[model samples]
Target: MSDMEDCCDLQLCLDEIPSTFNLEKAVCNHGFFMMAPNSWIPSTKTLRRPLRLADFSASVVVSISQPPGPSSTVLLLRVHREQVIRMLRLSERDERNVKEFHKVHPEAKDRGFGRVFRSPSLFEDVVKSILLCNCQLSSKRKKRRQEKDGANPVPAEMEGEEVDLGNFPSPKELANLDADYLQSKCKLGYRTNYILKLAMEIEEGKLKIDGYEGVQDAASCRILIKGISGVGSFARASVLMCLGFYDEVPWDSETIKFLKHVHAREGCTKKTIKSDLKEIYDKYAPFQCLAYWFELLEFYERRFGKLSELSHTMYHKVSSSTQMREFNHNHVL
Candidate 1:
């Protein structure tokens, strides 16, 4: 990160650009955008985060920005951490999914959106998914970010900035960590063993998560991902969604909150939401998760404000208290 001239830049050609791509909606549409090692910089209209280079030698902090000129074909990325450039480089399937998803969801089509941002690496998505399980999301997100910052502080890419940013620990890094260390340092509680085992499995060649990305069948993908040590139903569905198979929506407290406010489902639990979502949401087919997500997002905006403008650390902001307040104020009359 030292050499000032070591900065790398990439120009994405028109062929790679989506016809209706909007960077803000794609990156900020998901809570993952608010998690550690990922950030949406509103001030600069860029997404900044640490990316592990293809060589796997190191993680480099990269800034992805769209050009301000008339050209719509290219995105400019300036990464001072390394000479290699990569950030959300999409595939043909990804583009096609965006197009197909936009067609069904009118609000998304109107906004030129449908893709939710995820880590460029499948490993990062997997590990983050584990941490998110059995915990409060927004708080756990901040906790994981803080813990990671303290655990692995990388040198600041900026020359004069006396602050160093944290990188999410890579599989190799986590594989070498002790369970006690992980639990205590990360405050991971019971999730410590799941993560430790998962990292070790990947490191030892017992499991290959990246291969799961090519899986097109939802049920098969779920089985394979859940085969991992720590990945259960929620985490498996989450990883599946990350892999672009969104036939299922991962249900949690937020799912209940969404069902309550948006669908007026009084007693929908995680167990029941899937059936409910199927009847209400499955017509969208493979994009059921996307459809479900936008409904939740639109409701959030209607209640709170634009998610892109809100503090990224506070996702959804849908604690029971928040919902109760909304209910009382709106339903009191």
Candidate 2:
């Protein structure tokens, strides 16, 4: 069986490690890390961000045996360094990116914006972006009520469902599933067809979704994602950001809320958005996406507690409702 189909779990040992490898900072928020709240292993006061062997990519489950402390040597799941960089965006090589970002925003000198959470596959990133586009803040209280009632989105495997790979569904699995079953069970809404089409095309080898990894430019990535059904500008931007491009900051109602809450930028409209984003985040330049996300992480850390210490149940309360509205969404982490 391919790695995606086996139950094998392993630990990664690294030769060279980045100085900014804090597990607390890396897996801070469910939204930031793409990990389900329930999936995170617990931690006590002394030990933060306790090691857990959750799904890494496709079917490779491994744990980070060590946390980022005084040591320069980091331990991770035994994946290629390129794959690690693809997921966490952290490596010794990323020090330059972090240094450049800090040069623009001096306040972030100590804060670790070095890590940005992402999915194991570009397809998963695109799928989650579709879910994000459908999110609404119209009823925050109602969303919380659903979670409090134990109505959060369940992983495909946890839905009394099983496959050769007990993690995220492979494209073959997704392509074979009944469309109606995926929609109602996963609460995918109109995105069902979009996701299924992508899965089908990939499974048949008619579309080369994986090949985009070789395309180094974000603009090209955006164009590539735009071709998929139901992928709008926001979704494209989001997928690009996850692909480590950061060419644009995918803004939504949450962006408006954060700007008003933090920067006191009232009356931000479409005409004013460019200026607003520029004023607030342009200083971080090419790394503006990371800068914005780091600020969110910082805010959550102070308001809530360190995410590592919080139970997955409590984490569910704060995770995006949009995340809870999809099928197999939890597996995206």
Candidate 3:
């Protein structure tokens, strides 16, 4: 039997979440939550995803939900407790960040959205950043596609049912995966080698992605993350944010659109976003990303309604909703 098959599963109901941690707000706070393997059940207000074991030998699907009532929240995890805690932002470090972030953006404090969710491990976050880098190969960059994927759009039959999503692979798993398989199966395009190299480096211990978790400085983390192949300034910022350093907000074409449409800021493009980051988000200081995300969450909810109520199938609309909605209104779709 395969290692995954050999691994015995455990029913873990960890109520270790912070009192202020809102499951829906935290899980649906970021674009990563909508990606593959991270399934957010709107009806149940639960997050279901596969978490790789600490040793990377196997993975287990974890259904994390904040059940209503007197009992504490239960997460169906069978892996390391630390992994679950970190993924759910239950660690002391996460608590400190949330506390500080709330102080920076008190508006978000009341909204219960300071904890931006991330992958279970640094390797997962790194690979996820790579996958997000060139999403043109995926559904992210589609221009003239279905606009009915977000905000109360899922097919009626699919509601209240669990949709099986793929697992986010670890360094060891991806390192062993064939390049051709990655290209054909994942449609990675030019990013295949970058991912392969990163996976191999992590598996071989040549690249210490996890060691930087202890480093609190975003600059140092950005430099180290940028050193990884395929990681640019934007990806570096994103990885840093995942590492609990929210000082930097990654900017791209989407960011330009968000600024132009949401904030009515003209002359805002990818070329000028980095220089404009401070002027745009400095008020939030170390919680700049959270501040930026707060506006995004506000804009999203205003445009399409509360994201928490958005169906999982419709979650695809989120990444491009701002741009797509404006485009659809102008042009016939």
Candidate 4:
């Protein structure tokens, strides 16, 4: 570790950033890591063969030929050496936001609240948000099919399913893909049209997806994001979360359930969701999303382990068996 400490040695350090940048909270920072396609191994925090933004010509390939284990973070990082550098661009705005957040919620200073996980490209984030809405049905179908075939039907990683957890297809790549191919191969369902429409828009210059990099106002940003076909309020909020805007909470059924079960609140229907959230978490101000997420992670860590520590097999078992308990014996005691 000491030998690899210099930025020049690894070519990973920005002018001021340290070699030992912390990624401990990345797994719990957002749903991207958890819901990511199979190429992303959550346990080790390794993205296999991610495409570098600098070079779309080919993926930054690295071999994971050996068996999975409780590999060191250093070992895992070797697999994504270049992509890590591209993903962690700490801008002045990000720094200011992080400092402001910690000042308001000093307790979250070390808990990784301010720094959320993001995809290497905005295009990836947009597509991932679409996938989040539709993939559950496909996963269910896969689960049923596996059961019928008497396959292990456990987590995909444990089965060593040799699928290409390939690079998130670029807009050009996606624009070229037909609807049938996206639906059949990517299991995108009806989301296939939305994704293709977005990709085509980008490809044709009707929408400047990269211009969103300068977006400052969350409300305006949400409006712009929601204009994408099939993007609803929840999906817009999620994309905002990934983009470092935490003012809006992505309140969907999962959010409602978590709020009710954890806060012991009743009568929290969709109509009253905003008021219910405000009553419980307005104290955190602009960083209310962080507060909600940290508490959620606390619940998950108690029931399982830190999500990043769970191996593929263990992750499947826990994800399948664990239900949210309003009052866990451990919490009560």
The residue pairs that clash in candidate 4, if any, are none
2 against 3, candidate with superior TM-score: 3
Clashes of each: 0, 4, 1, 0
Best prediction by TM-score? 3
Better of 3 and 4 by TM-score: 3
Best prediction by lDDT: 3
Per-model lDDT: 0.65, 0.60, 0.69, 0.58
lDDT of 3 by residue, 226-301 (tens): 6799898777877888889888887777778888887777888766777677787898897888899888889888
Model 3, 83: alpha-carbon shift in Å?
A: 1.8
Residue-level lDDT of model 1, residues 11-84, one tens digit each, is 65545654756566667676666555565666556777666555567656677777665346766675643221
How far residue 84's Cα lies from its native spot in candidate 4, in Å, is: 3.4
User: Cα RMSD (Å) per model?
Assistant: 8.5, 5.6, 6.5, 8.7
Q: Given candidate 2, what's the lDDT at residue 104?
A: 80
Where is model 4 more than 4 Å wrong at Cα? 1-9, 14-21, 35-49, 53-55, 62-86, 134-165, 314-333
* Candidate 2 per-residue C-alpha lDDT over 1-333 given as tens digits, one digit per residue, 9 for 90 to 100: 354322334444444444556555555543734343213444421111111123433334333435445664554444333444555555444555656766787666676556566665677677777777856544775556456646655444233233233345667778888888787677667878888898899888877888987777776777787778878877877777776666477787777877778778888876687679888777677888777877777777787777666654454456665544345443332
